[model samples]
Each structure stands twice: as C-alpha cells, then as structure tokens.
Target: MDDEVRELNLTIDLCLRIGEVLLSSGAGAADVTATMQSVAHHLGLRRPDTDVTFTGLSMSYQRSPEEPPIVLLRQVKQRDIDYDILTRVDHLVRDVLAGRLDLFLARSQMATIVSVPRSRRRWAITLGWGVMCAAVAFFLGGNVVVAGTAFLAAAAIDRLQLLMSRRRLPTFYLQVAGGFVATLFAVGVASTDLPADPSLVVTANIIMLLAGIGFMGAIQDALTGFYVTSGARIIEAMMATAGIIAGVSGGLSVGALFGVSVGRFDPGRMLDVEGLAIVVVGSAVAAAAFAFSSYAPRRSLAPIALIASGATAIHALVIAQDIGRTWAAGLAAFFVGLVAYAVAGRVRVPPLVVAVSAIVPLLPGLSIYRGLSLLADGGSGTSMGLLAMITAASVAIALASGVILGEYVAQPLKKEARRLEDRLAGPRLVGPLRAKGRPR
Candidate 1:
C-alpha cells in the first residue's frame, strides 16, 4: 500500500511483461531471463532473482539481507510471434537502459506496447503460407499441378487452423487436422490423372506446420542449460509433429481402404543450374512468406528473403557435392546464423527473427513425410522408416546447433562493436543514477 511497495510492484510488472513478450515470441529462456534481470537492475532494483519457465515467469526483489523479498509471478498461457511488437519491446529496453525513460514513462510505453492492436493481415498470412508451400513444392521437384495442389492445400489448412484457433482448439489437434487435409487432398489428387508428384504436397504442408513451433528456441534453451523450459518446448514440438504423423497415417489408411494408392517419395535432383536457381528462389519466397505470416515489419522482409535464399543456395551447393543431408543442413544453418548476426543489425531486425524464418526452407519435411509414408505402407520398409526418422531428428538438431555455434562466434565481435559505439556516442541521459523506490 505504501509508495515503496507500489513502485516495487510496478517495476516487477514491467520486467515480467518484457520477459513474457520475449518468451512468447520464441526467444530462448536464457536471453529472456538475462534481459529481464538487466531491465530490473537498470531500473534501480539490485540482484533480482529471476525464474523463467515455459508457462510462467517469476522475479524476487530483496531490499536487504534482513528483509523478506518481494516476489511476483506472471503466467503466460498463450504465445504467438509478433515481430513488430518484438522490435518495439527491444527498443523500449534500449531506451530504458539509456535512461531516456523513467518509471512513469516506461510504464506508459509498456502499456502502449501491450495495447497496440494486432495487425489485420490475416489474408496476407493465408496467402503467404500458400505461396511458401507452393514454392517449396517446386523446389522439391514437384510439377506444376503438384505445386498448385500444394498451394490450395496449404491455403485451406491455414484457414482451417485459423478457424480452430479462434475456437481455442489445442495446437496438437490443429496439427492433426492440418495434416489430414493436406494428405487427403494430395492423395485425392494423386488418384486422378494429374501426372504430378503428389507426395511433394504432403511434404510442403508438413514444413508449414513445423514452422508454427519454435524448434530453434527449444534446442537453444536445451543447449544453454535451461533444461525445464527446453523440455517443455521439445515436448510441445514433438506432440505437434506426432499429431501430423498420426493424421497422415490415418489419412493414408483411409485412402487405401478406398483403393487409392498415393505415390511414394522420390527426391529429385539438385545438381543442375536450373535446380540450384529454383532452390534459391524458392527459399527466398518461403522465408519471406514465413516472415509475413509472423507479422514481421515490411521493412525487414527483403533482408529475410536474402538471408534465406543465400542460406539455401549454400545448402544446395553442399548437397550437389554429395554431402550428407545432415551435414549440408548444418553447414547452411551455420551460414545463416553467421550472416544473420551481421545483416540483422544493419537492417535493425533481431538476428533470431531472420535466422529462424530463413531456416524454414531447409527443414526435413521430406524425411518426415517419407517416414510417415513408410509407416503407412505397413511392411518391408521398417528399417528405412526408422532411418528416415533418425535423419529427421538429426537434421533438426544440426540446424539448431549450427546456428548457436555461429552466434557464439559472432557475439564477441558484436560486443566489442557495441562498446566502441557507446564510447563514441558518449554518456546517456540517466548517467546510471540510483534513485529511491518510493516517491518523495
């Protein structure tokens, strides 16, 4: 009830709000905790103990060794990526650190940040998903008909998922439903005389579904020793993936009952100049579409596309040399992370935003679809199916680990550059002042 207590409450609120936004936007737990703690310290709270989990965040502030700490907790029940909001929050943190914003102003800014309306780009997102999936289909060697089928299938899945989201349906269920629609449509198309590779449609749609979960953040947290949060993230991703697998399997079984035989997967060539160009162009479109679907700022779109295209071009070149898929993906992801750190700062977008979106084109969707298809066949490919599953897991891990290693390589130089910039820019407005919590 006192001024000191009120101020403490407000400070805690602001810290947790920032953390929630970062976590929900797919940042690693370590980053969220460190950032929240930094904001707390800069706001005059010393040595705050912060705990961040998948479902909630907590921070405790102690006045002294003698007094009990003031503890606060905020639960995060829902999460979606909104990079527009993320950029604002990122700037807000920098402004607060520079002492350009005091408690009242900071609170006001936080309120505005939270209250800003969501973008009315649902149609754009739907169209982007369709285009992304269609482009991926072409990259994977699908013919024109297959690409069109993938576009229609992905667009339908997006609409259905959006509808289910508004109804509060669970993500696992949505994944399952999405997979069902994709498979059913692809198989149905295959049943006709389309002369196209329908399997590519399933693979393309799988990649789109996988994009909804943040596997990179999960892996980063696990590698960084945030076991609890990492475990939760991994579980969520696995459950969603499993739902897709189950749905695909179910659809195939039903198709077989109706006497429809979906064609098996055949990975097309990637060695030719035309193929390589397709890979680059498709990757750029896929990444840009993903960025749009996540509501990234328009200014950031072109940079994201460039990163994705270059990364995938590297991946294609590596694959052309007969390198293993896992190694190729890892190498390309490393390039993505390395390039992202340099370019992202120049574009005024977070590296993770571009890195994660750019990697979408390279996910092991074909491997997953192959594994599921083998499982649905019910005989003679059990070992191959197992290998495909292993490959998928390995590719996922390699993609995430490579990016982390790249960031580790980039951080030192980035920090030195930051220090140099600060030195040249001179002191900020706050001058690192330590004011009392209570109002006079």
Candidate 2:
C-alpha cells in the first residue's frame, strides 16, 4: 500500500507539472486537460480526472473502485507564452503514450522541461524585437525614416520592459511604461525638424505591444465554453490595453505642454499597395521575429515566416477587393490556421505555434492605436473612437475564431492518428523505434 501510494503521488505530480508547463505556454485548456488525462492513463493510473483553467489546474486519480481517490492541484502563477516549451512537453507526452518513457524517467524529464531555460542569446532576442517592430512599420507602408524610429523605439521599450520585469513591477505598469517609452520617442522626434512620420512609430510600437497579449487564446476560450477562464483573459487583455492607452495619453499630454502637436492619422492610406511587395515580404520577417521573441525554436522560423507571408498576401488581396478589413483579416487568419495544420506536420511543430505566430502581423494594433489616439485628443471624436474600438474587438475575435474553426476542421484526423500511434507496438516515427527482433 505504501509503494502504491508513493507511485500514485508521483504520477499525479508528473501530470500536474506537465499541465502547468502546457497552460503557461498558451496551450488551450481542453488540450491541457485532455493531455493530462491521457498521460495519467497511459502511465497505468485508472480513471484520472483533470480540470484546467486560465490560472491553474487540478487533477485527481483513482487506483481502484474501493480505494479512495488521490487528488492533486497546482496553481500556475506565471503565464508566459513559450512555444519551444510547449513543443517539448507535447513530444514528451507522445513518447510516454507510446510506452517508450517509463514513469520514473518521465518525472525527471518533466523537471527539465519545466525549467524553461532561455536557449536564444539575449542580444538575439533584443535584435529580434527591434527588427520585428521595424519590419511592421515597413509592412504598414512607412518610409525609411519611420522604420528607423520604430526600430529604435521598440528596442528601447523592450529593454525598459526587461528592466521593469527585473524590478518585479506589475504587468499593467509595465504596459503603461512601454507605451510611454514609445510615445515619448515619437513626440521627441516630432518636436525636432526630422523629416519622419512620427505617427508611424507609435503605430508600429502599439502593434508590438498588442502582439504580446493572447487575444486569440482569449477568444478561443470564450467560444469553447470556458467562460470563466475566458472572462479572466478578456479582462486581462482589456486592462493591458487600457494601460497602453493611459500611458500614451499621458505622454501626449506632456507633448501638448511642450507645444508638440501629434496629429490624427489618415486611415485612407493604411492599406495602400503601391509598394505592397515590400509589405508582404516584411510581414514574413516580422512574423518570424515575433516568434523568436516568444522563444520559438530556430528550426520552426522558416515555416512560420512562410505561413505569415501567405496570410498577409491573402489579407492584402481581399482588402484590395473592397472587402471589410475585419472580414479580410478573418479570412486570412482562417487560411493561416488551415495551412499551419498541414505545414506543422512537415515542419515537425505544433499547429497552434505556427498559427499564433503567423497571425501576429494581422492583429488590430493599428486600429486600437488609432482609437486611443482619438480619445487622447480631447475626446472630440468620441463616437468615432468607440467605433474604432469596436472594429478592433471585432477583428480580434474574428482572427481567433477563424483559427479555432480551422483547427477544429483539421484536428479530428490528427487525434485519431495519435491514438493509433499509441496503440501500435511497432516502430513509429514520433517515438523511439522498437528494437529489431526484441519484442512482439
């Protein structure tokens, strides 16, 4: 009985650790719970129940009908999206399910997986963030001067965010600080006689800020009936956005005091395509750079870049036909999800990682920034500001839901394939192959 209890505890511990890593790395709640249950069952535990949410996970296991159940819970406090970690845990689960990894070895590997040491060099990460923001400016039709300003401002913001994080500042304040950092740069540049579009700098940096939030995950949770977790994530996104608004507003106020004028942006030229080839190519580079910011593996960058460029091309094509921006974005993101599913297999990465990274270029950062800019200017166009905000929200939900629908269409067969791999006794591609003449 003592040995059995110890084994049960170890199994539960492994499941909870895996669940924590998956959830933190932005895996959907359903996937986390299902994966945990599958792992527990494959490890010889009977009738495991797993509950997943935005913040934490709880799992229980029973050995026999007459025996009392062992319940275990883990509260996940830190949530940073690291696709590399998610992929590792995902592969580990498959290996365990294939009976290649035993319980004892699994526990040790789980510890290493959860450690999550950053593999990419620090300078590389900073360069990635800077280039990504600059590439976004180029994609948005900014000139050389505007892209340069965006690159510098984004680099500074990334460094500031790192410092704030080291000081253990709240994320809300960090968002505010980041917004202020970018706006301050924009206003300072505008105050000078530099021949640059300062507005483009703000727009690019805003997109970077918006890109880091899990708008897609939030909408996915809501649509899938995980209301509580969805609500939490929605509120968090909103607050982070609000922080950016507040910070930008404050910076603009200071600029007004210094006699600097931040003019309203003209929306007519936002999607112009006179030089669209540059935009499309830059979108690919920007998407890959953003993925690196989240610690995605180097091998996955090429596929992610291709997927993002395709989505951008579709979005630009649809918008050229006079389709609504919201609808165009949705269509493009749906295609991204669908293509990611097929390409992920070839690239040996999960579809969600590719889809999320690919869709980064299409997020409604410009719309959100435009709305906030309007509101900061004495609230004269309040109705129009509200409309822009609504449009931004619509685009966000559309992007997320489109991806979810595409995954839903692609996943049934994939799940069946995984199950078949689990049941097979022969050598398989994903796990360690059976030794020749050793078993069966």
Candidate 3:
C-alpha cells in the first residue's frame, strides 16, 4: 500500500511539472491539459482530472471511490520564449507516451530540460534580435542605412530591457522602456542628414516588441473553450501592447517639441512586384532571426525561413490583387498553420515554434504605429487614428484565428484523425494527439 501511494505521488508530480513547462512556454490551456492527462494516463493514473489556468496547473487522481484523491498543484512563475526547451520537453513527452521511457527516467529528463542553461549566449540572442529588426526595416522598403539604424536601435532596446529584467522590473515597464528607446533612436536619426526613413525604423522596432506577446496562444485558448485562461492571456497581451503605446506616445511628444517627426502615416502603401524578391528575402531572414533570438533549436532555422518565405509570397500576391490586408494576412497565416505540423515533425520541434516564428513577419506593426502617430497629432486625424487602430486589431484577430483554423484542418490529416475528429477536441500543437499504450 505504501509503495503504491508513493508511485501515485510521483506520477502526479511529473504531470504537474510537464503542465507547468507547457503553460509557461505559451502552450494553450487545452494543449497543456491534454498533455498532462496523457502523461498521467500513461503512468497508470486512470482518469486524472486536470485543470489549467494562466498562472497555475493542478491535477487530481483517485485510486478508487474507497480512497482519497491525490491532488498536486504547480505554479508557473516564469514566461519566457525558449523554443529549445520546448522542443526538448516535447521530445521527452513523446518518449514517455511511447512506453520507451519509464516514469523515473522521464522525470530526470524533464528536470535536465528545465534546469540546463541555453546553448546560445545572451549576446548572441541580442544580436539575433538586432538582425530581425534590420530585416523588418528592409521588408518595409527601407534602404541599407535605415536597416542599419534599426539594427542598432533594436540591440540597444534588448540590452536596456535585459538590464531592467535583471532588476526584476515588470514586463509592462520593460516594454515601455523598449518603445521609448526605439522611438528616441528614430528621432535622433530623423534629426540627421541621412536619407533613411525614421518611420521605417520605428515600425520595425514596434514589430520586434509585439512579436513576444502570445496573441496566437490567447486566441487558441478562446477557441478551445478555456475562457478564463483566454481572458487572462488577452488582458496580459493588451497590457504589454499598451505599454508600448505609452512609451511611443511619450517619445513622439518629445520629438514634436524638438521639431522632429517620423512623418505622416501612409495607408495606401502596398507591396509592388518590382521589390517582391527583396521583401521575400527580408521576411525569411526576419522569421529565422526571431527564432534564433528566442533560442529555437538550431536545426529548425532553415525550415522556418522556408515557411516564412512562402507565407510572405502568398500574402504579397493576395495583396497585389487588391484584397483587404486583413484577408491577406489571414490567408498567409492559414498557410503557416497548414504546413507547420509537417515541417515541425521533420525538424523535431513543436508546431507552435514554426507557426509563431513564421507569422512574426506579418504582424500589424505599421498599422499600430500609424494609429499611435495620428492619435498623438490629435486634431482632425483622431478618427483616422482610431480607424488604423481598429484595422490593426482586425489583422491581429485574423492572424490568430486563421492559424488555428489551419491547425484544425491539418490535425485531422495526421494519424490521430479519429480522436481529433471529435467536436470537443482541439488540435494538438504541443503534445501527442493520441496516447500510445493502454494503462498498466
């Protein structure tokens, strides 16, 4: 009886740990809950009840009606984007589900995955962020000088945010600081005689800041019926974005005082066929660089670049046909969702890694900046500013929903079609869709 009780406790602990990692790494509540249940089921815990919130995870199991339930809860304190850790943990879960790894060995592997330091140095990751911003500048039709300025501004923002994070400052404040730095850099550049567009630089940095928030994950949770967790994620993403807005607004006010501006927003700008090749290359580089900055597995970079390039081409082609930007973005994101699973399997990483990274280049940064700039100028342009902001929100929602719909379509094509075909079951982005072996 004592031995059985001990085993039960160990199994619950393992499940909670797995849940914590998935939740912290930006997996949707449905994915986390499904993964935890699969782990518990494989470890001989029949019918364990699992609950996932934005900040905590809990699991409970009972041997029989005659005995009490063993419940365990784990709090997720850190929310960082380390796709390498996510990939390693994902592999560990698969091995356990396959019956190749026993309970104790799986626990050991999980511990190492969470405890080990990242392979890339902090400086390398910061450099990757700089490269990503530079690529975004080029994608926005900026010249080499503009790209260089964006690169410098992004590196400085990363370093400043790092320092603030080390001091244990809140993420919202860090975002504000990053926005301020990016805008200040743009302002200084505008005051120079250089022939670069300061607006492009600020827009690029805005995308960089927006990329880290989990807008996709938030929408996924909502679609999967995790309303509480979805609401929490939505609030968090809004708060972070609001921080960026506040900082950029402050900087724009300062720039106004200094007689320097990022110029007026142009809503009519569209991608032309002449520069399509350059934009495609820029998009690919931006996606891969973002993955690198987030510490994605080295093996996943090429595939991510390829996927992002394809998505960019699709978006450009659609936009060239005079389709709405929101529709174009949704179609591109749908392609990302459709292909991410097959690509992730080949590269041995979670599909979420590929999907999220590939979609980064398409975020509505320009619209966001345009709206803020107009609002700041605030006379007759207030209505236009609000319209731009609404457009930005629509694009964001379309991107998230499009990716999820793609997942819904793609998952049923895999071997787990039977389980995934159930109306109540959501697509699996981070865990096995079907358990491997029967309970012991």
Best by lDDT: 3
What RMSD value applies to candidate 3? 2.0
Q: Please tell me which model should have the higher lDDT, number 1 or number 2.
A: 1
- TM, every model: 0.92, 0.91, 0.97
- CA lDDT of 76 in candidate 2? 84
Q: What's model 2's overall lDDT?
A: 0.77
Cand. 1 TM to true fold:
0.92
What stretches of model 1 exceed 4 Å from their correct place?
270-274, 415-440
144-242, model 1: which lDDT tens digit per residue? 898899999999999998899899999999999999999998889978987887788899999999887878878888877788999999999899989
Best first by lDDT, ranked: 3, 1, 2
Candidate 2 matches the true fold with a TM-score of 0.91
Better model by lDDT, 1 or 3? 3
lDDT of 2 by residue, 1-440 (tens): 69979988998899899878876766556556556767777777755776778888888876678988889889987755677777787788878988889999998887887675767777778888889999988888778888888999888998898898888888899899988888898898889887877877887888888887878667766765677877888898899888887888787788889988666666556567776687689899999999898888888899999889988888888888898889998999888877777787777766778888899888887787788777766456777888888998899888988887766555444654443322212112122221121112
Could you tell me how far off, in angstroms, the CA of residue 215 lies in candidate 2 after the best superposition? 1.5
Better of 2 and 3 by TM-score: 3
Query: For each candidate, how many residue pairs have backbone atoms clashing (under 3 Å)?
Result: 0, 0, 0
**Candidate 3: tens digits of C-alpha lDDT, residues 350-426:** 99999999999999999989999989878998999999889888988988988889988998787756565224337
